[model samples]
Target chain A: MTGVEGYMYPNEIRLYWSVLIVLYPYITGLVAGAFILASLERIFRVEAVKPTYRLALLTAMAFLLDAPLPLLFHLGHPERAWEMYFTPHKTSAMAMFGYVYLWYLMAVLTFEIWLDYRRDIVLRSQQTKGILRVIYKIMTLGSSNISERALNIDERVGWLVTLIGIPSAFLLHGYVGFIFGSLKSNPWWDSPLMPVVFIFSAMVSGIAAVMLFYMLLTKMRHKTIDMRCVDAIAMYMFYIFIIDFSLEMLDLVHRIYEANESFRSLNFLVHTKLYFSQIILQILIGTITPLVLLFITQVVKLPEIARKRMYTVSGILALIGIFAMRWNVVIGGQLFSKSFLGYTSYKIHLVTREGLLVALGLTMLPLIFLWILLKLLPPWEDEGAHAPAAGD
Target chain B: MNGFKDIEHLFRFAGLFVIAILVFLVVRGFIVPKSFGEYGHYRAAAIPQIAALPLHYAGHQACISCHSDIQAVKSKGMHAGVNCEACHGALEKHVLDPINVVPVKLNTAVLCVRCHAASAAKPKSFPQVNAAEHANGIACETCHNPHSPAIDAGGTK
Candidate 1:
């Protein structure tokens, strides 16, 4: 590796835009998306999606735990990151992260999860033994009674959290886009449409993840497939993907039309370093192909087997494609020098912590959390087991 | 009764064990070895540190004390406020053996980048230089006095 010694301009004046900035939003996008998927079943009362509702919640929680990890790692002094909350300045865009994260985690997701699982928690608290019992007891936090009134209250609270959560989800990912949009130094990122593109892409990613997870869980367990649930998810995903893909193209069109001074170099960089990701993976493979498949399947009202297969495949492809888009935007944008004089390559080390290895670890950590969450709360249990009969 | 309960617990244990090992290996690989005091000084050994020499501050006083005539000439000239040791770095070695020791070279553009690079906390207060344009053709000390270039040489405020 060649030394960057003296090659860099003065640290104060130069903007050290790095991939870590993009990773921060990428992780948050997963969190917001997963939670929104959970809300579809839990709040919207979509009985078809019941099997995956709890799983989606668990997935959201798992990724949410690590959402701030990339941000901490990227800071020059990670310890000082907490100061954004402790010594917040009103004008600073970064200071608002603490409040946003807290509102989602503490108020929205946590409350929703508790209301959804309160009956299960009360029942399990009685049967579970040893440390696991204690863990559940702590999780339930001294609330063990299960009643008709309590269940009604739980439903009421669930509705409130999910209702508040949609706008919260938009704000969470939208703000991240604002960070890039507001940055006036780089002409490539300076655009007002950035936040809208980010929110729609987040929704697409979220729905795609849920569809893939539900399919994978069924296949792994060798259970009878739930086609109705998959169909509903696919329909929602197809509509969102259409809008998301269009907004992304709109951003690209704006860039092309404006043709600013930085446009030539930015365009060249995209064609060179980001062509495969932006054009092929994101647009064609990730968005269009899956979109077309979903549309055809939904419109035709295809058989159960075909619909499940198509949704699963499309969902997986969409997830991979969206991640590739994030990679292109985050890593690609930084490859060119700010001077616009020359292009420097970023070589990611294979074994290093800040390299691809850490990223893979962060991605997989959520899967492990989801597994544990499933064991704790089997989402497939019939509602009759927890609630009273219809008439009596 | 079947042993489904024990088997489920076993699955959880196995899953956790596998994840723990994966995390350990990744963390171990990325952790940098401790060096350079508590701040764990950057392993930028390719570039030498300026902290070791006496040329930074005290050496400037010595030069001003002994070579008052040249100092006077410099005082009347453009380089007035800049301490003598600022560019010369630590000057003890040069002061001890003035004939043998080489004075620090203020010759290259790299010196400018060392302070001008984006990460720099207190970058020198100057208009941003065009690196591609100014980097190759000139030396930093050629146009401006190293000691107090802003104040002394031709005295432009």
Candidate 2:
């Protein structure tokens, strides 16, 4: 048997634990974030969030549409991936991803979006032209009017879906953390706190995405910014960060308290490869800075312009920080070999299919989809305004 | 707006009708279990395998009759559960024809990877399927004994 060539054949280093794990967290983050975006109006009853509700749903749906793409692409034989369900006896925590993805896509996200949009589809089908009109017709299933009773039903159904979705969203991303945590082999990921940390960070990332998109789009439209909505989102992001940060510390503390045989190597790896990330980016700028800033704004009531700046900047940082956390978890865990004999390094490639370029492209595809979805179903329309919330 | 309201009501009524149809289909989706005899009826019509006779492995007893010591030697682990006819790929023709049948080559790694693949048992510790560590150089027979796995230890002094 030939040795799995290492540095000489970079592609042959198939199990380095760099990109695959990052992809899992990133996808789950989107699912959690998207659902949180929808929850803004549904759970909290923010009316100014009306413009963003449909957009958020579409964004979530879009990201979720591509959620399984990374997994399929990463599979050795992508074609045989569906064979997972047929043979559940071979089930692992990762195998549960297929079922989770399907439930979210089919039951929660897809159904919720369709129920919300069905009335809109009926209203807009006749007004639109060409392929979009055809799509509207198919989407509406030929209904072209929104009745009061129907709207009420939609609102009830949408609300119910949203409620169901919240737990499923947690399950979706939390399960990824569970996947990492379940692996007792990796000391870095084996903590029980992993799922909570992933879920909270997911909310932070999701809210940040919403703020970023909201700011950019409103700027594009030259529409007055919804300071209330932005501030509300920022506030939530801050709260989640506090929870996320504390949980992270709890994880570290637990690890430190135990200080197993693997501690020295893991500690060195963190101090060296992950020190800048965990200390500076995730801790100071990502968590503490944003927390203080958001806290100050929340308490003292900063001027609108200042609040906007703080929210946008903090949101962007939070997004980056969460991505960093993912990078650390995914790549960090792999740094120390199971043998604990020595440490191996992961060098990220710039151009491979599973490289940075593809990751960037996959991230952008949802944004592009959100743009088109916004155009197709402008949430600001009169019908869109009074559109029934998830779970009427 | 009043006329539009009426049209909206009509659409809602129609929508409810459509949803009712969908609900009916959903509720009706459960498959009723049928008897094996009923299954056999369908299988009898469409299945070609019914006419074929079951292939039997000429007993390992016979092979042991000639090569008793050799069978005893190989019967440690992986080969323990398996009979001589399995890897030899149906030795009926080899026994009867006695002229042209060739025993199949057993590449231990190939056979082991078939079951140990990620699709088989999802090893959470490793990220990739058919882990690169094992896929690299370790032969299946090295770690696992083919005869009787319970009895076969990794070859050691």
Candidate 3:
């Protein structure tokens, strides 16, 4: 009531979905986008993008493993979540998440990562000695066949899995979009374009994440940054970013031009409550700045160092913008009352269950997972036992 | 059998997947409610489970059945439509064991104005009053008979 401006429904005072829900789609976007970037090399025969294939896969794997944490933390009884799988209501969009997540994680992602790494796992199981050897052996699933014919089968199957993975990645994030889009009760989330926008935005975030990680990790290792690889990646990232921006603008313009009954409430929310996150962080700094910077690298002939610096800054900006976009969608949707008369406020607690601390921890947890993953299964071609095959 | 050795591990992988699915199927059979998908999408037993809950507030009919004297005065007053539990709170336990479970005496001073507190949102026809100007720090029941709000108890108004 203190935050309320006009007549508000009593139940509208406290926002239900916290910043944790915001992190859910954001993490899932990174997962989807990274997987799609991996696919660009695997399926499209984009040789210049080949340097990032394994890194993208590992990045996707790391994030994919931790994607459900926010939801798990947010649920009242986190233990009862298996019921989403055990007794699913087929009609509920949210219910299908368990299966979609499992399909992507287990069926698509794990299987693909395993297939690609099986040759290494089998070799390491025999080559290594000690605890890590056990991990490799168990990972090999009792397979010692890393022969030419055996690896050929693995490659062939891995290609097929990558083929399936492209759509599964789309389904993985597009479904996240559909969850919000299908919520007809809320005006902010209800959009036919939500899934497509989510997929493309996911692509932008995923590619940018891999790019940044690639640059950072390379710098740390004192390895030369592969200009050809990053250039191709930047080109794709730029084009996809354009599409993502256009769709978002289309949604914004459509809402502004139509100026429906809910527009006044949403407009007020954008100008007031969501002024910084939506307008400043998401649109101006997050989106436009990066797009302009990336555009410069595309047209203008700049030094490699200058281009690299721009790309790094742009990647960081794009990620921040996408995160702000998710925050605006999740938090902003709940800020305004459904009555279209009043507004509410959301202040995320620092130490509570669904607080900023937990959200920040969850965001960082994947990078730790990636670190462990990179150590266990080094995505670098030079480090890996198996070379990137000339996929037939 | 001879060539199976070349792809023995792949077969083992598929076998493991099959076993996992079987395990899930077995577990699903144990946990999933039998009544689920019986009546549309929800568990049908939920209705019965909910119906079996202990009642907290006895219906107004139960109150009037015994306390007909108060009901007689209340029926003719401005508060006729208001139920006893609306002001007094839930009394199912009191109704069941009236001797041991005595209902707490409500402070009518604060309780009365919950609905009567003047707000622009309330319907114009409904009775409302500004607490400061109307009472000047006095209890509402001291001036007005709560059972019959129009009848002044103290003749102060």
Candidate 4:
């Protein structure tokens, strides 16, 4: 009664999808994005991006591990989620998510990362002592042969896995888009281009995140930053970001042009309820500003330090923008009622299961995963067994 | 298979994946609902299980059987079509033990506002009101009889 305006169905007064659902897409997008970046070196032969290959893989793996957590937290009967995998409804898009997530996590990402790191794992299995040695030995899965020929097979399989990973990464995030876009029930989410937009934005966000990580990690290690690698990453990020922005604009323009029945309500939502997240955080600060920063570094011959600064700022903004885009989609979509005559609000609780604290904890959980992953199977050449270079 | 000497690890991985898939399928066969996919993707028994749930709201016939006077009053007015349980909620317990299971007093101010509140989406023919402006949170029963809401009970309207 307090927040309700105009008219709303009794059920429409409370929004089911909260910030936890917001974190769902953001995490999946990061995982998809990171895997795509790793694939650039492995599949596309983008040698300049080689320095970040293993790091990207680890980042993807870490985030992928945490991706389903939000959904688990959001469910009323969290335990019954297994029922989805057990009795997957054929007609449901969300039902397919479990299979897709597992396939990507197991069949694609873990397989590729393991193959790439297998030689190292085998080496460490022999070189390390005690408990650590046992862990590495188990990780080897009883294939301890690090012979030159065995390593050759690992490389070949890893490359093939990378080849599969590119499309798997697309499906991973594109499906997240379809979850929304397929909802003809909500005009805000209904769009044919949603998946494509999600994929490109995934690429953009993933590339930028890895770039930031690569630079920061290198600095933390007191090592020289890979200018060429970051440069190539920035260039690709800029191009993909342009495409992502164009598609989003196309969606917006189409909505405005069609001016469909739900248009006025949605338009009002974007202007009023969604002004900060959509207009300020997503478009102006997140997208355009970073695009400008990247474009500047592209045309001008700035010093490495200046270039790094620009790249850093752009990466932070890109992540924020993509997150805002997700916020606008999940939260903003629910602000207006289906009756088309009223609006409601979402207030994220503090101490509840699907609360702000859990959301924050989930966001940070990947970084902790990355830390553990790094410590266990170090991605750095000096720290871990570096997989063989591109060709034999 | 003859010259696969150095690639034993590849064979091991392939074997491992095959075993995992088999294990998953075998386990799924046992855990998944037996009647699942009989008529559709979900368990066919779900329909009957849901149908078997105990009825909470006794039909109006059961209520009017005992209290025909109230039904006569309700039937004579615009509230004739509205069911007793619509306002009284589930009455199966009340029907069984009417004396001990008396329904609690409802806040008519709140209850009446649920349907009568001004909403643009409501059909124009419905006698909706801006309840806040109309009575300033006063109980609907203060001025109007709920059974025949069109008539003012207290002669205050």
Candidate 5:
């Protein structure tokens, strides 16, 4: 009752979905967007974007590995999750997640990464000695053939997989959007534009993440950052960000214009309860600031250092904006009751199963996975010949 | 011919992937409940499994077995349709083993006022009261029997 401002349905007092649900879509969007960026190089033949190609794939893989974790942690019975796969209900949107996840994990991301790195994996296995050597050998799956013809086939198949992967990535994130959008009971979430906005925003966030990682890793390696690659990535991020912003605004404007019975309640919620997260953090600071920074780089010919700094700032802001967007969608949608007459506040716990601590750990877990993945399969093409020693 | 030999391992790996998926699907088929997908998308067996759970609210029959006097008074009152558990909390344990489990003694003002609280949203026909104005520091049970809220009485039946 302390958080409750008005009369709420007895059952609507507690929010069923937590911050972890927000993270689920946020993390999956990054995976989808990163994969799509990677495919731009492989399928679209965007050679200028080739430097971040492998980095994008590995980034996607790392985040994809972390994506299901939030859902698992959020479940009342984590052990019963496999039941979604074992006894999937045909009608439920959530029931299809298990299969879609498996397909993207195995048939798309993992297979593509393996095929692209088959030659390098075999080479690394033979070159290294000790536990890592055994690990790489196992990863190779007994195929040591890296001849010209073998490499040719790997490239061909990898291309086909990337072509398939582009759509799969769309399905992966679009389906997540549909889950929230299709719920007609919540006017805040119900929108036909939700999936399209989700897909574009995902691209924006994923590209931003990879760009930041590319710059950070290159600096750590003491190598020159690929200007062309970052430039192209920024260009794509800029265009996609515009589309994402437009779609979101369109949804907002439509909601305002329609002004249905639920409008007054939802509008009051946005202005009052969600004012900071939605208006301040998401729109002004997170979205417009990053868009302006990226747009500046597009028009002005700045020094390399200046451009890098701008891109870095923009990328970080974009990531924050997209995350805020997800938070607004997930948490804001539940702030008001379905009765459209009351409101409640979300108090995040510190040590509970789906607490802030767990959310932080789950968020950081992807970077840890990415670090290991980078070590396992160095995305740097130049290092292919003198591959870093395993576990190095 | 030479190229085919070089990529033969890739084919084998693909074959293994397919076989692994098939095996998983087969196992899933066996594990799924037989009655699933009967009435709807969910497992029909879950209906019985859920219904068979220990009745925590102690249906009216269970409450009347011991408190028959209260039931007679409640049957003729406006609160007849409302179950005892609606206010008193679940009493399955108290009903089965009264020596160990006890039915909670609720605060009458807090318990009764929840439904009868003055709210514009509440229907006009239903009895409504402002606890602050109607009883001010007095308990609801001081004036009305909880089992028969419509009858203003000083004590329980």
Candidate 6:
């Protein structure tokens, strides 16, 4: 009663999609975008970004693993989710997600990672002892021969997978965009540009995330930061962020110029309820600030320390902006009634299954997984020197 | 020949992945309902399962059977076509087990105003009244019999 203003339909008072739905696309976009960054090194042969290649793949896998947990937790009957795979509705775009996810996970990310790491895994298996040795051995899947010819084949096959993975990554996140964009009744979400915007923003966020991880991890390991890699990544993030901003603005301008029946309600909702999230957080702080920071780094010659600081700040801002973009798209779309005559509010619970606490835990779960993944398979080249000999 | 031996394990791993997927598909084939894809995408059995649900609404016939007096008046009114359950809520329990279940008494003004409240969106021909101006805190049943709203106390009927 308090949040309700004017006349919402009896059913419209409660929003069906919650914050978990916002996390779903945001998480998937990271997976897609990170995979694309990894591919830039493997497929595009961008030598400068080679430092973050393994890190990017591992990051993508970490987030990819966490992507479905939100959707599963949100379902009233989570156990019945296998129905999407068992008896999929041919017409439903959502039903196709299971297959798409499987293809990306098994055929693209997992396969590509396995091929890339096959030689390292094999070498580690022979060069370790006790539980770690057995773990690496099992990971090798009984493949211990890391001959030059074998490694060559691995590189070739991995390259081919990365080539396939770029488009698969696009399909993965573009499909997420289509899910919201296809909803004709919601004028706020229904736009042909949604998938393209989602793809470009995903690239921005993914590149930013990998860049930050590369800088932070290098500093943590007492190694010098890879300035060339960060510079290249920051450049990509900047250009993609510009495109993403342009597309969103194009959508906004078109809506205002058209001034359709739903425009007044949408405009009012933006000015009032969405002012902080959309305008302040997403547009100004998250997007413009980060874009300007990255632009300054590109145009002006700065000290290495200054550039590192700039990239770090810009990367964090890019991530926040992309996340805010997802939040606005998912939450803002539901804040107003389909009738365009009323508005309702979202109240995020703390302890419930689909609550703020659960979302925070889910968000942190990926970083934890990434930490474990890094420990198990050290992506650094120097890891082999510290490993025990096969004879020992 | 030595180079090919190093790559042999890769083939085995690929085969295992393929076989695992095949096994899942085979299991899925068995678990999925037989009539699932017969009509469209949904399970066809769901149609009959839903149709077999217990009726919650007592049809007009059931209401008229017990309250013929009200039915006679309602038959002559503008609301004759509208089902009694639409305004009164489902009365199947009250009709079937009168001792335990009692029909809910609705607030008459609120019930009438739900449909008749003045709104620019409503069709111009449809009867619309500003409930606040018309009722002025008085119940609708004070002036009009809900069964025959047009017939007044002035002996016009």
Which is the leading candidate under TM-score?
6
Candidate closest to the true structure, highest DockQ: 4
The per-residue C-alpha lDDT of model 4 at residue A56 equals 96
lDDT of 2 by residue, A1-392 (tens): 13221222233234455575586678669668868878879877877666677767877877887777777656668877755543333346766777788778777887787777776777567667899888888877555456676667678877988999999999999998888888887787888889888898898887778778878888887788888777777777778788888999888888888899888878877887678887788777777787888888889967898988888878878877888788888877766655444455576678886777877777777778777878777755543534445896
Backbone clashes for every candidate come to 24, 23, 0, 0, 0, 0
Q: What TM-score number comes out for model 4?
A: 0.90
* Docking quality tier of model 2: incorrect
Lowest-sum lDDT 10-residue window in model 1 chain A: A3-12
DockQ of each: 0.05, 0.08, 0.50, 0.56, 0.44, 0.51
Superposed on all Cα atoms, the candidates' RMSDs to the truth, in angstroms, are 10.5, 9.3, 3.7, 3.8, 4.3, 2.9
Instruction: Name model 1 segments beyond 4 Å from true.
Output: A1-22, A42-48, A383-392, B1-86, B90-157
Give the per-residue lDDT digits (tens) of candidate 1, residues A143-173: 5556566566567767887889888888888
Interface RMSD of 2: 10.6
lDDT digits (tens) for residues B93-113 of candidate 6: 888898889877889889999
Minimum summed lDDT over a 10-residue window in model 5 chain A is located at A381-390
Model 5: runs farther than 4 Å from truth? Answer: A386-392, B1-3, B22-77, B83-111, B119-121, B137-157
lDDT against the true structure, per candidate, is 0.70, 0.71, 0.90, 0.89, 0.90, 0.87
Q: Where does candidate 2 stray beyond 4 Å? A: A1-14, A381-392, B1-157
Error of 1 at A62 (Å): 1.5
Q: Indicate the residue-level lDDT of A243 in model 1.
A: 89
Measured with DockQ on alpha carbons, how good is candidate 4? 0.56
Per-model TM-score versus the true fold = 0.74, 0.70, 0.91, 0.90, 0.88, 0.91
Task: Tell me the spans in candidate 6 whose CA falls farther than 4 Å from its real position.
Answer: A384-392, B1-6, B46-53, B61-76, B93-107, B117-133, B151-157
